[model samples]
Target: MSDKPYQDKAVIVTGASSGIGRALALRLADQGAWITLAARDAARLAVLAEECRQRGGKAIAVPTGVTGEAQCKALIERAVAEFGRLDVLINNAGIGATGLLEELPDLTLFKRVMDVNFYGVVYCTYYAVKHLKQTQGRIVNISSLGGKSPLPYNSNYNASKYAVHGFSDSVRMELAQAGVSVTLICPYWVVTEFHERLMDKDGTPRGPQGRAIYSEKTMTADQCAATTLKAAARRKREVLMGPGWLTVWLRIIAPGLVDKITIEMVLKPLVRRAEKTQSKE
Candidate 1:
């Protein structure tokens, strides 16, 4: 808990059923913030809400799929109705897409990724803005390092995060005048269920690439959550986790060098490992 406890402050955390959202929700609850846990998984959300309650904060579960405008609006309304007012909106709900764009047999995967990762944030923020402005609240966007630098073989995911970055940048300025802070959370690679949800063909998980991303070269959700909450409290314009701070600048300093390292560390290796897995399976 911070020195300045949230007490009765209301916070809504989308994707709170699991991963970083769950961790952040718990942290906020410990800081005495009233919490609304939102996700499509009702069972999981209920469990999380209970955990928040155990931490000594008021909490409710709102099972939500952020792709719909109506649902997003309802989520904000419910939070206000439950807690009397809204203080923060954390747009942490997102899906992942890995593997080469050309190899993806289902083109709809592109749209679905954008719908959840990009449009979900847009819908939730659009509805929550009124309450946020009313409270001089904060908008925390859980973006990715893909938003900052190139992520090879994951073009759709990259594009969606880049969209998120653009949207947050525009709104951060717009909301600044209103005293509602907008924060873009750019995490490099988080160990979470997101990669498992990255479907390839017919809802099958993208094989080795997803496995590699989750099991290797990733930061824990708790660490990411702690960083995110601190940033939100500080009303930071943007926060980049892990290697993002160095890597994003490195891209500007040495694009060609970065491209060469990316190919070696990411592109070729992922393709090779995925192909090898396919052969074995």
Candidate 2:
């Protein structure tokens, strides 16, 4: 394997506006990759594309909302047209929601989460598979620990990730013979804007205290991105970061204990914080 695996390779990173996706794109830029930055925020993507160019990679900013199939198709088409071939597809676009399932005002919240987190992945992969097979390239699906172990008050988010988990695994099997590799990345609590963007029962962003509690724990986005790239380079089928594996193990060996910990240590703190924030409001 080359020291710079991404050198000259054409890679597409969804959710390139910020968080893990942004971090990963910058790192790939450092490796001299030809990068296609995809996200809804055109301004952010443009800025990131310039940064990638400064870091020694060729980059193009494509403002894309991955939830739509036509948009996803266009993203792939544009990347191939620019770079001539597709080497990697990072399905890093995702959204989050909080609140117990029953507390949610309507099931549309679930649909909204699923559309971005799950269907976005499906649509991108559907279009990218043929190109990936042509290059014997890779597909990296960004998932979460919640996908493996149910997290309290995050049913919508969990369900979407769970679907991603299943989809990635099934696609890996289907594409194995085609020389297309699928890697699923599950990370627990990375310090990202994800928490701040997490929606509440009414589809509004959750309070600051909820975001703060998560930032207090876990690794940074850069750390997660570095680990992710290493895993992708090795074509790892699945990689769990931070306390992700421990949480999954505990869930298997001591399901009840895991449940208690999730409720007491994780869920209750957020609930208390939310209540405290609401009291002041």
Candidate 3:
């Protein structure tokens, strides 16, 4: 790519406390970008900020909840104040849960996930668009495999990601004339705290699905982050990485066949495990 684009640019990464977000922030910082780290966990954000600063780039922590438009705007404002202008905004703050839709004890978490995953993206983009237009900047949204293809146990997460995928695509078209690039990074099963945070209806950590998926093939957060930065530098409209990319085309070409494989490979085994656990209980 044409001589590293991040140097001396202002980039904001939500969910910067850990995982792909943190990896991206550090990677960008190493390239001399002034990094704004945004996340709900203030302490972890602070730690990451220091780490970024030590990496030979400027860094700051903005404790933000993307669910609120005001906070999202504030995040941009802080970035501009610190770095003079914003070049990239990564909408990556999100969370999810695991349970069958029929078994979920409360629907509130569904809304929570949507508010954070989809609406959070909308809020950040709504505020970032103006500055991006001026800088002719890029907006990258961290979507998921779930966005393109729904997963077995994560109905709420699938909906939220699908919304993100839809929203990012529509805006990418609208903002083209304005010279702002919108890129969506869709990956499957990276190593992250995502699974540990996902809860069952009973408030307990969910079962082995995440682990099972990882056991098959999981990308490291740093690897995903590097791919994202590389894609963003080229201003690619969309980047789909990992084995999950195959499933998307399979779903399009032979949906019934894909569904049958999903049933046998993923759904049935997980369902049997659940049944066994319930019987023991």
Best by lDDT: 2
lDDT of 1 by residue, 1-281 (tens): 45644667899999999889998888888888899999999999998889899988889999999988899999999999999899999999988767687787878888888998999999999989989999999999999888999779878888999999999999988988899998999987788777766775445775545556565556889889988988888888888788878998999999999999999998898889778978999
What TM-score would every model get versus the actual structure?
A: 0.93, 0.94, 0.94
TM-score of 3: 0.94
What's the lDDT for residue 179 in model 2? 87
lDDT of each: 0.87, 0.92, 0.88
Look at candidate 3 and tell me the lDDT of residue 222.
Answer: 91
TM-score of 2: 0.94
Pairs that collide in candidate 1 are none
Stretches of candidate 2 off by over 4 Å are 207-210, 214-217, 268-281
- How many residue pairs clash per model? 0, 0, 0
| Model 2: how far residue 244 lies from native, Å | 1.7
Span of 10 residues, lowest total lDDT, candidate 2: 208-217
How much does candidate 1 score in TM-score?
0.93
RMSD of 1: 2.2
In model 2, what is the error at residue 209, expressed in angstroms? 4.4
Please estimate how well model 2 matches the true structure, expressed as its whole-model Cα lDDT.
0.92
lDDT of 1 at 235: 89
